[model samples]
Target: MLNRFKSVVSNVMGGLPAIPHQTEIPEDPNSLQVKFHYNRPDFLFLTSDEVELTADHISRPILVPRCVNKLPWKAGYAEVINAGKSKSNEDQATAMHFHIMAHMTETLLNKTDNQVEMTDMANTGGEFDNSLEYTYFAIFDGHAGTGAALMASNTLHKHIQERLLEVKDLLLCSNEDKMNDILKKRNMSANVNLPTKRITKDSLVKGALETAFCDMDEQIARERTTFRIKGGCTALVALFFGAKLYVANAGDCRAVIYRGEEIIPMSTDFTPVSERKRIAYLGYLQPELLHNEFTHLEFQKRVHRRDIGKKILCRDALMDGWFYKTVEEQDLKYPLIYGEGKRTRVLATIGVTRGFGDHDLKVHSSDIHIKPFLSPVPEVQVYDMTSCEHTEDDILVMGSDGLWDVMTNQDTGRIVREDLRKFSQNEDSRYTSAAQELVSKARGHLHPKGRGWRMENDRPSSGDDITAFIIPLSQLNSPSCSINTQNGHIPEKLENG
Candidate 1:
């Protein structure tokens, strides 16, 4: 399948080629660098400063390092040495957290803008007394600009960590009316009368992830005027604590795990098409937000005033049915959900319906801010990895959409299994190597005999910035395993909506 990043922001932003632009490399490559490729049409990255990486993005892609280089963190990074509530000085688990990137597909932009962070949550001064016990992993895919993605990579986890106590406290407190109101606003089912002791681990984690996204987005918007940061990014993160794994996402990025050969998605992708009703309903409730320029009702193409009063098939915002309605004068307005597929956009100004950044951004020539429609509320998913039976091949793959655009969850699971079968963890080219191979397959190699040639089932590589982490859950099995996630990316350029 052709990997075409939708031009979600192009209606106002201008157009560019869908293919990734590459610069000629000098003979004898100096070094290999893993960079984030924001799937935008514009080369918004201006800085050349090297970012300090916490994951294995800089070092060689070796899954099982043979002491080739000093590991950034101690080996068995995922090993949860602290089994009980008492905080231990030793690092958590031995389950490796390795990040590898291929300089993403974009034109003329040499520097990669994507960022990832994996660390023991203990270091960050979170509100939770047991903060030292959890592990955090996230991938921030930026587009249009790098500032937002960079900021998210550095701060989102901290927000999550800090909110841990707030969420738990809120759930435990007796403030029923306030808690119910908050839960209702988040669209979560509310049961404030339930005793605090009955609160499930899932509820606490969900409240934490949701509240963290809210806090993170608020911070981003506040910092926009101060930091002059433009653009936005999708966040996918995983929080591992005790026996449960919490996965949360705000954009197109994905998290997939294997229950033996069965593929399960830990997070949901928030695209215009998937979020049509919610967006349309928001537009319905607040028509002024449309500025008389867009309609909550969506259509295949633009609706001109000339077509007013014409009968057309339409999707209702409140109902789960498709019916025909006569195009009123209001129906001729620009659609709230514009375009189609990957390119479909919520407001014709941005591609992603949810995520962080774009705070100071306004619709071109108008003071109307699009941030009102965009959100940072992540869909958090919980998995009991601790309860599942383990196999050597059982792995958790978290990747940017670049990997998913070309491969399905099943395809990824199959490839991972095959790679392990061919190259075991005992070999140097283990998980990280398999990740690179998976990236290569999604981002097919260049022309002629490569990705350009397009084989019968051409799955050579991804033209987007490809970053993936292949975690060995089998190794992290120290009586407990937990999880959460981050997601989304803006294209470098967008054609007219």
Candidate 2:
């Protein structure tokens, strides 16, 4: 994992890999390690050979799913390998539809002789409003290695479903009357009492999402000791449940909604530059995490040895504005965070501040662990899908940092709008075309004579891995996809524009 990061820093240095302190982990010959092979999303339907071909840095082909029907809502997807940054594409994505069984709720509520029993009500085999169906979309941007991203793509949704099942009963209780009726019918169990404070259904769903992310991260940490999981990854997930859309993000990947003439941001990037204070505060709280080689304070400029005992413009963990402080011997240590914008780094190591794995990640050659300063918690945002009237033109575009590195939210919306207008109303492939257009625009054209890739505006193109998903919000607005309170069976009539 550190080797890949070293290559990135090496490329930035315009020469050989210059980061010397970072080293690769030596494999133990006697220990058994279960490893997961790299491959594209199964929905893409690419053969094993084709998956390997997609990683070719020389050709750098943009890959999309074989059929639009592979994804629900006829979602569009596209991805491309980096310009030799790593041997394989570190980014991975997932699109899945999950059904919460009615029995799951009864299994939790049914009881007999102080023991939970699968009673007749639990095995009724009947559909009810208590059951639910939801769609999940996620992107994992891996760094160093693809192990963490691969595991996240393969298992994160299962964790989410597990958490959702735990709260199925509460999710069904929409109001006080419904909750009281269900509680009374279940027979006054002291073990299952409502909270002292009022809790909204939205809060239950959000908590499920938040805890799911934590569970996924914890699994990675626990299994890595016995498995071959390497490095870490940022997770960005969008859950379409009931009549609401919940976005939980813990990394640099972003999600934006295109509605009419405006672009709505659904997720925020968690980078060292954006979350400096939170990381700095942790450093200040536990100085031992820094190993005495780093400080929680940030200065406008690097403090030289001569500057010691002199006042310098600085900002501490709590201060936002810079203030003059005398530089002491400890202040001469490296700042907890360094650089700005895309160049920002924590301990002069990783760029992102939140995500999964990275339990063994340390600062270069030091013993300081980076995981303590990193977070697995995601920032969640919710949008009521029923509150807005969305048309076929409206879409939710989710992409890794590679896509956003070159294009702004407005630029992406404009391009998607332009591409969607090119196809007729009945074209189902338009969404895929729109996704392809976004990847193409971000990747740009490779130049000859070793000049490297250049964007349409003559700027350097993104050399990192790129992945994007274009989901039509029109499906969410369609009556066929909505929950049926009377029959509990939603008609499968989701169509693409």
Candidate 3:
């Protein structure tokens, strides 16, 4: 059994308001210590304040000044277990593989504003190859607060699982023998009314996935209605099944795969401008004329007032509010007073271009020609399946931009590699124990009082929610080519265009 021990030593200072006095300090130390009895667990410490005391540095513990104020602190861990072990003992050689250990942690940073940071993990057991098993890992980066990131991280594993199951069902249905066997076993009539014949399992699964995203978009729209905040999140997912790896992403969240000492990016960032071109090509551009009124009538009036006839500005009209105002004012009083017309400014509201929500901006041509703002439709990308070769070990790191902000890619990879080496020298070591040590090292390097830990805004570091999971490929049991054989050879190159 793996256990975690957390000790919080908070010291209270009570003395003259402005005077420095030496008092008997409480036996409780101000620093937190996490010691493991069975395994060498990793330590992650987040503090609010730091102070200098007696030539030594100490974290100034957070104080709750108001009775109604709530101080935020949250952390938890999960343990993954074998799925089949809990169900039956039918087959010992069935390759009953699953994540045996999983955990997550969340901490509230600000109470009034509800600011928080969270990290979690998802593991879908190794494939049943009876040969070799591999693990899949992913990390989510969320902005505009932690809710979106939390939701994405918690739901992503299930989404991929369902997708894989759909794929399996499709393959099963494709085999005519399997379908006939099912009919015979269930004693179902051949002419019985079955759902649409045109509906294949593959098409239904793809449609289901698409519909799930659409429904999520609707929920996001409804949530945005209550708040005026503008921002969205990004997600990066990495899958490892057998010797093949696949990655998919939308928005800016990234996934980096490590093959030996080098790092490879598996996804692309989707920006607003890229999505705009698609929307425009879809015949969604602002109408040239509302019924019969010229869309650029106001613009033309401005040109005439400036005595520059038929001259196209060529600038992005969507962003230049001045140009829109010049046009609208010119349209209001066109031709009559070219030089001496009183100038008036009409402000138009423009929406964002790309994001998960903001349906209001997705209005079609019939809607009034409110100045064009950007939209937030995310660009989704998938990586081609590729086989990674490693001599001794391989490390995979998945994190939000928060970790990137504090440590470079090389630095993160090196730290994980060094920690792995330490465990290698000790034969009686646990991977999870080493993982915790790696996290501790990262926290130490970025802690306030630690050698390089910077102090900013009374928090440990300006780091965002940092979450990572590492896998040692060499130590894992190699399953036979069961997945490839059962699933019918996965393609070597499956890149998204």
Candidate 4:
């Protein structure tokens, strides 16, 4: 079957060689060392041979965790490699608990000496205060390479932990009367004197998430000087802290809440077309960035050399509607943003406007860097899980663009919900089964005659690497969900799974 699958793909492309992805190893073997080897997320619990099976483009098996205990809430996760798009799956995902150690802040306040240092929880032989725990789920969709995605999947949570720890007091304070007292202690510990500003719990978490993305991106940039971290990737993260669910997005990856039959969008897709105004405005502000090879103006049609000075329908960075503008020599240059819908490209190079680590990506045959135009800051949206009632059927679905490329949010919700109906709510594998069904629908089956992969309806299936997570929101409030941790990265045995 696998051989036949490969033969079909070969014939479909007319025997053309697969194009090299951005994450491919450089021809020069002596470049700086790549920081890490490509691997599936540890939570997946795949054996070495099973990991190898994931890279088989022809088989394109939808990989899922072998054990229900692998994820919190027995969350369902499924991923598949693209059909000969890259040498390996460029997408990466992580599911873990980030513990904001309560002892650090508690020790500082109780100790008489201001110079007293906090000891590590492991060294102290103390248990973690599970109340301050936060659940983190993220998906990184690599474009040029998997390095950025791999790097993010491994360390992005640490950056978030650092930021969250800074405001741990505010996050834990439930009494409104003690809010100012908490702020006073926070100011005293830092040895700083500044007027207090109104701070909300959700805002603190959101700010932490936003800054964490920036820190993660900065780390990738700084480390790349000594390490070979190829390509860039879009990030979509869903963080569950206290009663709130925060979704931070910095690229085309998406997150949605499926409550009952309703599909609530939690993040936006920052594509070139969706972010046209922002991209074009930057081009207008810094024309030098274009290298005179592109223009910020948008035209109804490409302005030809012969049509210079002719009237054309156009719009500028400030206007939304097209106006009649006289074409000029500059207008003949390529538009800063090109194509439409999923085909949109910035400076005719990248499709995404926000992500991490594309520092060296330049325009084809030009010195113009695309990094300046790309942003690592994520737009965070919050959903209060405590505000409403939820059931086992309610879930948070997060996926890379590969899944969304071929499925709508409603379609995804319906597939997951319908598949989940086959099993009892207590059966955690039900979620995994739902995730598998979601991935399978997006991935589809090989087309008849091996021409190409296609869906049941005969539409082309998603050829990009697809990943999905179905997290039951009903388990959010369960006490057994916390990850006992001495340090952030090390996962202790869960009290409950």
Candidate 5:
């Protein structure tokens, strides 16, 4: 019984290999003294203040006090976690700060993962710029590994800043008509007789964001071997400047804006089920991607090899119901679409359909790749926030699937509204505090005996990692007070054209 007890302890200490970055805890007495190399130092082991940020560096040209060190204001942050490795608590809320120069995503010489950065005002503006400053926020949710998230968090803003800087030139070149319209709206006439260029701010900004996402993914794939980085992550970013709000996302992570009392989505959550049509379309184009091992058809469940030549039930096109048909040899093959909604997976492995990294991902227990089906391009949502009205209660909420799994966007909005109303008299009830409240609700309550956990609704607790950012729209949109809502979603460049 003692030997069995030791075996169980060893297994528990190791956790599951399926969980990314987890390994077998050693049985050796001096194992703690051993230097176990990881892609980056565990933030769990560092104090929130000690974590890196752009503001912390003395070399920052535009030096500013760190967010954590600054006097509490309209915008703030909060986090809670029931899991992770730490000498103390499993929770970590550390954020890194970085300094950005004139619009350029400097090629990072180092490789890393699972990071966060903030900039009060990115230097992305026109020379005759109407807007003086802009703020940027993002959340990188890592899976399989953390490298992609860290790299993207570090460099994506730079790419955007650079692209936005060229807005004037692009506007002159690409869309002379639209550019003239915008200039005319400002009551400024451009020298239309001058040589016209072929790019517009619309096209430039769109191309830059999509390019940055893909570049970051490619960088992660290239550096994974050298950096020993594993896994992949979701990228959700928000760019609020002047009269416009740009929210771009490339995974299951999401961004939403709560204006007045309504819920406005800023980004789309890209999952296997949400992208079934696209996934099926790709599979149709490249049947060879199936490796003759899978079919693009949807069924009640995975079709069995022995089920060949038998009639079966399968789904047809989008929004259509499953129909009865005789199973062919192809039907007997494995399914390209597997799992169910949310848990719906691609190649029967990855749950997310769009994200960064995972370029080298192979099917579980097999060598077949799911990367061909994975993409890093983000869907860009452009919201003209300049013309929208706002209230102090209005906010922008960003969170990973962990929070969404237990709460719908509408439910979350209602909760925030109720909390703000109930705590209106509390002076300390800032946006981040509200974010903490939401995270706490999802985290649920620990058992009386300190065992499992459950939520107020009597539902199960969130089993995945959770993070939330509650940015006050008043704080961000105060001076601007401008426009609102999740407006039209525009794909990048000529892709839409």
Candidate 6:
């Protein structure tokens, strides 16, 4: 069956060979030798000066690690633990938290055919402001192809920072009357207005965030490049602002905060169609679409007929026939093509109701009839620096979906908590290495039965790409600062407070 589908795909591409699947290897072999440590009250840091000094470093494939022993699967299982006080008098008691998130790719290809762009800058003294300190982390999850994802991850941060600085004059106005006048003229709301009077170090943070995402979307369109993939990526960024943590998210890649054995999710999943209320708002009849067999059949038949140009509905023109041919050749029973014969009505093609970069698939709200099918606007979530409850002992875990696939939130929390406890109580314990160890452990846990073993289907489950960073709270003594210089590099500092 898979071969038949592959043949159809090859024929469609004019006999061009299908792209081969690629998998991630373990950490880069050329990666420098780095160590994580706490500097002062305002900062926690990881440095690789030695690793950077090491010449002739070789690149390594990022692959999953195989397990030496086997373990059973436990459905929805999670474990949490709390570490006691450390022997060291200077260190404060901190809490830990974690969570797991997973989503199936739209394509059936076993391998993770994606690309990632990651940049981490620390302890840099620059002209912007020597007094301020900061750190920046971003994860871009792309689909269809990795080009857009790579572009967005590499450039979004810098683009946003530049825009905020360009608008600094407008953001720094002190007079309320004048500010109000300018905002009203620009149609900016006074309620959520930027703090112009103070113009402190933290003032530009919010403005920079808003402009970054808004501008990046527009900039990509202007480039006139066909490399922009059809699907879009979800991004989650963490900016350590002064002593506080600021989180901004668009899409599902998540930022989770751990406060001493608890899991706090900092981002919301933007699934508009998944929500019943949103579905109803689009005028979709709930009962008619609620797992009803007849309704499903009717929708499939309608869509199939529309494909052949037999039926002309108000929304028929918007249907992209590319999906029709793909589905037919695969012999897949899509939602639009169900039932044996003579009875089918197309409801919808894709399952995800909201996403970016599918502007062509959108239906105008004024159309009234087909408005329900149009994609929802992207959602933006912001976590203020003041909102998070921070302590000297807290730890922050930022990761992609790969880590969450084989582990639970509770499992991660427990492992970190226990490791920290061991390190604190035993002077010889190397608990500081937990971050790198966790990644290796996760890779090993993937296939205790055997390498590439898929428990459900009895086939080799292609390993996922995993990237993560773990920071212990006590090491967070530096003032957190990030600058998205226009040059496409986001430099950050983890300074001692």
**Against the true structure, candidate 5 has what lDDT?**
0.57
Q: On residues 1-497, what C-alpha lDDT tens digit does candidate 1 reach at each position?
A: 00112343343334432222122222433342223232211111112221111112212121222221122221111111111111211111112122211221222112222222222222243334422245556776666656567666656665665556445434443455666555655553554454333345467778878998888888876765445444677888877655567888888888888768778789888887788888889989998888777778765455566777777777767766767777777676667776656666556656777788776665544555677888889898988876777676677788777668778898888777777778655654466556655655664434564324121275443445555667666655442222112222222221110
Q: In model 2, what is the error at residue 401, expressed in angstroms?
A: 0.3
Candidate 6, lDDT over the whole model: 0.37
Clashes of 6: 44
Candidate 2 regions off by >4 Å? Answer: 1-31, 105-128, 180-195, 477-497
lDDT of 3 by residue, 1-497 (tens): 00110000000112111111112222543332211011100111112111111012132111110111111100111111111111110100001122211121111111111111111112224322222122434444433333333433333344434434434433345454665555554544556555433333334333434444444445555554443312234555454443344454554444565667778765554433333333333322543312222222223223433543334432232333324232332333221111111111111111122224333431122342322332322333333333444534464455444445455677667766666666553242333444344344333333435444443333343223334444444433443111111222222221110
List ranges where model 6 is wrong by over 4 Å.
1-134, 166-208, 224-231, 242-244, 271-392, 422-432, 445-462, 472-497
Considering lDDT, which of the candidate structures 2 and 5 is the better prediction for this target? Answer: 2
User: What C-alpha lDDT, on a 0 to 100 scale, does residue 257 get in candidate 4?
Assistant: 93
RMSD in Å for all candidates: 13.8, 7.2, 19.7, 8.0, 11.8, 16.3
TM-score for candidate 4, please give it.
0.86
- TM of each candidate vs. truth: 0.67, 0.86, 0.43, 0.86, 0.70, 0.48
What's the lDDT for residue 17 in model 1? 25
Tens-digit lDDT track for model 2 on 376-495?
A: 999999988977888888899999999999999999999999999999866878898999888988988888767898888888998999999999998863422221122222212211
CA lDDT for candidate 2: 0.79
Clashing pairs in 4: 22-144, 23-144, 23-145
How many Å off is the CA of 419 in candidate 5?
3.0
Instruction: Kindly indicate the candidate among 1 and 5 with the higher TM-score.
Output: 5
- Per-candidate clashes come to 50, 0, 26, 3, 20, 44
Q: Weakest 10 consecutive residues, lDDT, candidate 4?
A: 488-497
Candidate 5 local lDDT, 177-220, one digit each (tens): 76655655444354455444444454556676788777777776
What ordering of candidates by TM-score runs from best to worst?
Answer: 2, 4, 5, 1, 6, 3
Per-residue C-alpha lDDT of model 6 across residues 244-328, encoded as one tens digit per residue? 5666665544556678767877665543323324543333344333233212111223234225533323211223232222222
Cα RMSD of predicted structure 5: 11.8
Error of 5 at 328 (Å): 2.2
